[model samples]
Target: MKRNPRKVRWTKAFRKAAGKEMTIDSTIDFEKRRNVPVRYDRDLVQTTIKAMKRVGEIKARRERAFFKNRMAVSRETQRAHRRKIIEGVKAGVKLHEPMSVESPVSSKVQEKIKVTAKRHTALLPGEGRSMGMDID
Candidate 1:
């Protein structure tokens, strides 16, 4: 039996789309050989990709903040636990789950990111068209 070729991934499509110099009539064809056609207008794809990247970036920043929050909480808990141990307390250490404490600055930044992503994803609705000028 012969093995089939691997399908083109969306990441590759995104990369291709990113570098493409698109025009009004240009389009980004997704899985061109498949029967169930899925296509994107040039402007729409560009905008969507931009929004996706922005969201990813924002999420990355949030992840860093979450880690920082976790570490701070962990350190405080550790100090308390050590103090208890030094005081000759026989009670088992009470572990506290790290909760993300949202700072006002971080919250405001996240809100702005959400607003930007929303605006970018809200593309104008229009008639769909067949893949015309291929970007790939």
Candidate 2:
């Protein structure tokens, strides 16, 4: 079967994804959600370009290397390696694992706090409980 790749215009701008990640999003009720932004770090990519040039190409070890040099690029030119590996795919190099609105939680921490009203209860095992917890 003949194959034709989808063409997309490239620019130095953040393009939002047409759809949301099904894994990261799951709707139970009839509520609706907006699409998550597909962010790309144009600046970071520029930084990586600078870093790569500065480091130069690293010498691939001589010992029986895993999966035989797929790109067969010289240790003198690094971009040559990436060019051979990634062909035609635009916007190369993934920028981090993406962002999320949720905060990271520790597994050992409790989710909710239980408040009990006591007139003479001890607070810190000996500090004597306060009258009430002012959440203000």
Residues 35-84 of candidate 1: C-alpha lDDT, one tens digit per residue? 76558689987987887677667666765765687679889999999997
Task: Please give the CA lDDT of all the candidate structures.
Answer: 0.57, 0.45
Can you write out model 2's per-residue Cα lDDT over 10-90, one digit (the tens) per residue?
321211131111222222122345388646799987986875554343212321242244334444367766786776454
Instruction: Give all TM-scores, in the order shown.
Output: 0.34, 0.15
TM-score result, candidate 1:
0.34
Local distance difference test, candidate 2: 0.45
Clashes of each: 0, 1
Model 2 TM-score, all chains together: 0.15
Which stretches of model 2 miss by more than 4 angstroms?
1-73, 76-78, 86-97, 101-109, 112-136
* Best-fitting candidate, scored by lDDT: 1
The C-alpha RMSD in Å for every predicted model, in order, reads 33.0, 30.2
